[model samples]
Target: MIESTAPLLSVRDLTVAFDTQNGTRQVLHGISFDVMAGETVAIVGESGSGKSTAATSIIKLLAGTGRITGGSITLDGEELTHLSEREMERVRGRAIGYVPQDPMSNLNPVWSIGFQVEEAVRANGLAQGRAAVRARAIEVLQQAGLADAAKRLRQFPHQFSGGMRQRALIGIGLAADPRLLIADEPTSALDVTVQRVILDHMASLTRDRGTSMLLITHDLGLAAERAERLIVMQNGSIVESGPSKEILQNPQHPYTKRLVAAAPSVASQRIQAVVEDRGVETLEDLAAIPPTVRVAGLTKDYRIRQGGFRSEMFRAVDDVSFEIPRGKTLALVGESGSGKSTVAKMVLKLEDPTSGTIEIDGMDVSGFSRAQSFGLRRRMQPVFQDPYGSLDPLRNLENTIAEPLEIHGVGDRASRRERVRELLDQVSLPQDLATRYPSELSGGQRQRVAIARALALKPDIVVLDEAVSALDVLVQAQILKLLADLQTELGLTYLFITHDLAVVRVSSDLVCVMERGRIVEQGTVDETFANPKQEYTSRLLEAIPGASIPLGGL
Candidate 1:
């Protein structure tokens, strides 16, 4: 049971604000909470809800714009809000560990994984011998369930996969044996299989070590699966606080009710099929004429070396074939290094297939020249998974949204601006936000801008690559509904590439399960989900947390 005595971490009237041009914006508005020893507490919120700011304030790592406006933060009964920078550095890695949402950005690109992990340990005054540090690093990595932990120590950040990178970050966080671990959206980027594995490992590790955790996430199901207690934040204040089971089963606040309801849980989808009937059984008999996009005998190979300079060809995607119908979505689901993104790249003409034929609108793009490729691009648009990266940081929203129209010379200046307004309205973004840059927008707003940009050319098909995965559950539902409406309005086809089966059920009309560079299962959304043939597909379905839990009655 969680201790009712003095908590491991305590916050009283905690407030933070950012000095923006719009004026000082209060983020965390006098929020209060206590995290008990050996307990998992989740700070659940939507975009701009101050979840991340609260976590950073504990470690004195709130970015430049944000400052602690009021109240106090106590770690093990010691005040942290007034700690000096130098003193806070000593407390950072030792007293409180932080795992940000994006490991790729947090981790140094140039440094070796082992060196970074060792450096973190050294920062905590654990300056042992290099051998001892390396041994401890490997032990932590193993504890995090990273495969071939010792051998992977020599690997660069790029060499490790997405899930592995997250694991590596966790290892680094635990290197100093911190009393408190703050994981900010830990499972946002992982697939169902890998996400469940990592989360389970983290729960077990924290419980065994008696470490307190403050998990910040938008995923309600994730909170139910991992957190013992839940704190729901909206705007900037705590809307509700209770045990996880209580919050999940009997959400009191309206925001919490909406959040729980908007979760497109796989279990809920499992019990009730999205489609009334199983229309298509095989790719061959999907539609009348042909598939919207078809790939047959596709292959891609990369060279990798072993101990010496001797190299071997690695087949990332080997003879893969699939079909997607018009005005429908086909989600290619898989974990990292499962050749999902590689296939997306090949489809987008970003990478050339070593041996294969890609048919779009029954036209083979295999040997397309620059002119031909440009034509194909005009008919197809891509909505990237990461909206921030997809857009230009320097350019304002108008320019970003108008880029495709400018490239294609589709309209004049005023016409393009008018088109941009229409697209923005479709995505339910404010027209005033058009002048803002990508950096100025929140994650949801940025994603909506990306969607507006994708729809600028009014392409026949749009590739939504994990488009809604990064969003809050409410925002995700909004985006999903927007996609569905657009599909109906424009008769647009979508290739929704995501590892999230929740997204698959919500956005996809058909499903294609991928594993280790191969398509394990392919059928209509109703057919495959209702009766998953592949064990991998079944496992993916099963890994979805809180799948069996119903939404609290609103």
Candidate 2:
């Protein structure tokens, strides 16, 4: 436990607001907290809970319309609220480091990784001259767990994978070794294993340097395991705050209890137990049933330039095969570039396979004509990972959902409008939200909208490519439950693609573990999770965050 002496950072009665077109709206009210030197504190909550807003407020990095309405932020007994913008700029990299939630948004795509890191190093006066800055940049990136930092420095943001980009952002944040580090959903976009690696590195680095960390995340299990102290926020206010273990074991607040109960890591254990005890049917049972979708030795290849005039064929999906029975889900689990999405694309006919046949409901889609492929789209639709990107910013909910129906010529304007309303209701969204734009909805709501749009054409096979990855645990549970209910009612087949093992445990009836473009292990969810045959599969299972903690005990 951290000694309650003069704290490293303190906040009291913090209130924040944003200037909307309708006028000023208070987002946070009278929130207070403290971070002791060398202590790790986590703020856990769902979207719109003001966790990120509070952290951003401390650094004065709030968006243009946002401002601290009432607050006192003190660091090292120095008042920070009254600091000028220029003074705050100096204090930012030197005194406080910030790692934003989305690396793509925070990182400049046009700049090289080395250039960004050096800019921070030079701006904070941590290093002088071109050679020193470059050396320091490599040192910091290597310290942040990036391999071959010196060589990778010249690469652009697009050239790096999601985990690599996040590591680069962390490198930039810790370049100057600030006294305090504010990490906002730093590992939310990564695979479970990659998330663990980055988080463990951050934890060790901060402890070694005696730098305090304010981790903002929506995963309660992660907070419980990693943070000594936990602050629970809901609807823009703190609902509870105390020792993380204490709060997890005996949550006093109802909201905190709900959050713990909805945590995917904890819920996954319960699912595993239920399936283990009840004994689910084997993969042979699935084989007996006629498959709605089947891929026989599916493979995809891309031509890549090797030299001046030489090219080589790169196999993206190598001999991957799986089957999904009618109304059942077959999850393709792997890290980034592990061919999960590529297999999904092939299954959906978005990408043509180099070899093997894809049969949907006994029809060979590989030989599908242009018109036939167009018709096949109505029976198979895709719900992508990023809801915001999948949704059209200019289109409202009604129009977005109705577009699919219009494209398929399923109905007239009036009928499509009615179908849109039904889809909204089916997904448990408000009727009034039909008029709202994509930006107006929360992450969960936008995902629900995406699901509604995918179901607009009454597709038989809905390919969900990391559909619930970006949502909070509570919202994720709701969406999964909604998907299960819809599957039961509509008899929909799902080709779910995700890197989250916990999600695979809960949502998938069968699991296909992919590694480097090949399915290493495939079986019923119970069989595969209980006794993984491949070392890679075992590593993936072990990498699930908070897996060491017992859900039943909590």
- What TM-score, computed on C-alpha atoms, does each candidate reach? 0.92, 0.95
Leading candidate by TM-score: 2
- lDDT, residue 361, candidate 1: 81
* C-alpha root-mean-square deviation, each candidate: 3.1, 2.6
- The residue-by-residue lDDT of candidate 2 on 208-327, one tens digit each, is 899999999997768877899999999889999999888887888888888877877613632321223545678888889899998999989999998799999899999988889997
Give the CA lDDT, 0 to 100, for residue 290 in model 1: 56
How many clashes does each candidate structure show, in the order listed?
A: 0, 0
Residue 10 CA displacement from its true place in model 2, Å: 1.2
| Clashing residue pairs, backbone N/CA/C < 3 A, model 2 | none
Q: Cα lDDT of all candidates, in order? A: 0.85, 0.89
Error (Å) of candidate 2 at residue 425 is 2.1
